[model samples]
Target: MSPYSPVAEPPPRVAARLRRPRRPRRGSALVRRAASPVALLVLWQLASATGVLSPDKLAPPAQILRAMVEEWHKGTLQAATGVSLQRVVIGFALGAVVAVVLAVVAGLSRIGDDTVDPPMQMLRTVPHLGLLPLLVLWLGIDEAPKIALIALGVTFPLYVNTVAGIRGVDRKLVETAGVLGLSWWGRLRHVVAPGALPSFLVGLRLSLGVAWLSLIVAEQINATSGIGYLVTDAASFGRTDVVVGGLIVYSLLGLATDAAVRLIERKALAWRLA
Candidate 1:
């Protein structure tokens, strides 16, 4: 080779520049998400304030805000919220437990699937809303009926999703666990429960929405307190602002609960990020 024969320069070093991550814009996400709702509120306020829309039909954002503040000051809103929260918590717990038990039985055993599935599928089809009259008649117009109503609404989605998730666990993994002599509970803990988590979370979110809806309906029937009572009371008294304000509270509660589920997902599913 000639002395000046082309010397191969070393391939350029693949330097990955460790640039600093962008600083999170504090409240940026909230502000961006608020855009559309804010615009709609602006339009609503303008129309109601300027008489472009009849206040008799609907209240403006300002009026709704004032009424909400008034209720808050009077402690009615707080009391109602507490009552409603209690009902939801109790109902959700009851429903979630029943759903998990039923799902486990149905998903894990052929006998259980045969016995539990048909009735559940049939029950899910009947609109639980229509059972309001029967519930009131049987259980009386009290907290028991309301709680039971909410429980019924919250159950089906969770049950369906959990069963699907459990059934979807990899048969191979399950067999391997069995071959390794894992006990029933051990196999479930290792191979089944983790696989079912995501679907269960999705069901949780869905069931929460249903729970609120059922509460709204249940409270409409002789409700003495709760956000639903607030709406019904306002409608009777012709206070459109208060009615709208109560609806806003419902929306906020739903949003907050969904956010909570999302937070749980982030923590529980951190393994996926790996």
Candidate 2:
């Protein structure tokens, strides 16, 4: 070895310092995430007070908060939220069952793929909004139409993601399973389900969002209750504060549901992360 090398090693302490991973800032990430929204509310309140933004056009955050409290006291907010949550839960459950069944059928067999995929592909392209009038005509201006719309909206994304997930499972792993004398059901239970789970969860998040959106649309026409009904009723009465409060309710509900799904994912997919 040459006595004088082109490069020299750093001291162990210096090298250790260079290799150390930077620690994240010490604080709750949730607080950091909330900073932007809190700042926006402050700006909105300032603008409303300064007359830079008209309360007639957009109610101040303070007014909206007051109106929300009043609605809660009167039981309107609680009732409307309950009804909306019930509708979403029922519709989502039904849609999830249907989507998983369809995905499994199509993903597992050529015959099923040919029979089920074509129709599904055709139907997914038809906007769910356009179906509202038709659904009302077919099912009447009742909870049935609203629930059906939400179910339809929740179905497609899950089906697509689940099917893709199953098909995307490693062919080599599948072959190995077969060579190991595993039955079809054994292969599916042991090898396929876990592989497909991540994609299915992604689909679940998308479906939940669509379910909320569909509920919003469905509640717009012939809706006697829900956050959407509250907004529409407020609009008719020219109560900007109530209207804004209803919208805030919808936003908060959406965030809460998404957070729930994320919690589920964190727990269910912990193995994958490991």
TM-score of each predicted structure versus truth? 0.86, 0.85
Write one digit per residue (lDDT tens) for candidate 2, span 122-240: 99998876899999999999899999999998899889989998999998999999999999999999889988987887788788888888898899999998888999999998889
Predicted candidate 1 versus true structure: per-residue lDDT over 1-274, tens digit per residue: 1111122211112121344555787678878889999999899999988899887799888888899999999999999989998998999899989999999999999999999989999998888878889999999998989999989988888898899989998899999999999999999999899988877877887788888878878988899989889889999988999998897787777777867876887788777644
Superposed by TM-score, candidate 2 places the C-alpha of residue 242 at a distance from the truth, in angstroms, of 1.4
Off by over 4 Å in 2: 1-36
- Relative to the unseen true structure, what is the C-alpha lDDT of residue 258 in candidate 1, on a scale of 0 to 100? 68
Model 1 Cα displacement at 184 (Å)?
1.5
Best by lDDT: 2
Number of colliding residue pairs in each model: 0, 0
Candidate 1 Cα misplacement greater than 4 A, ranges:
1-34
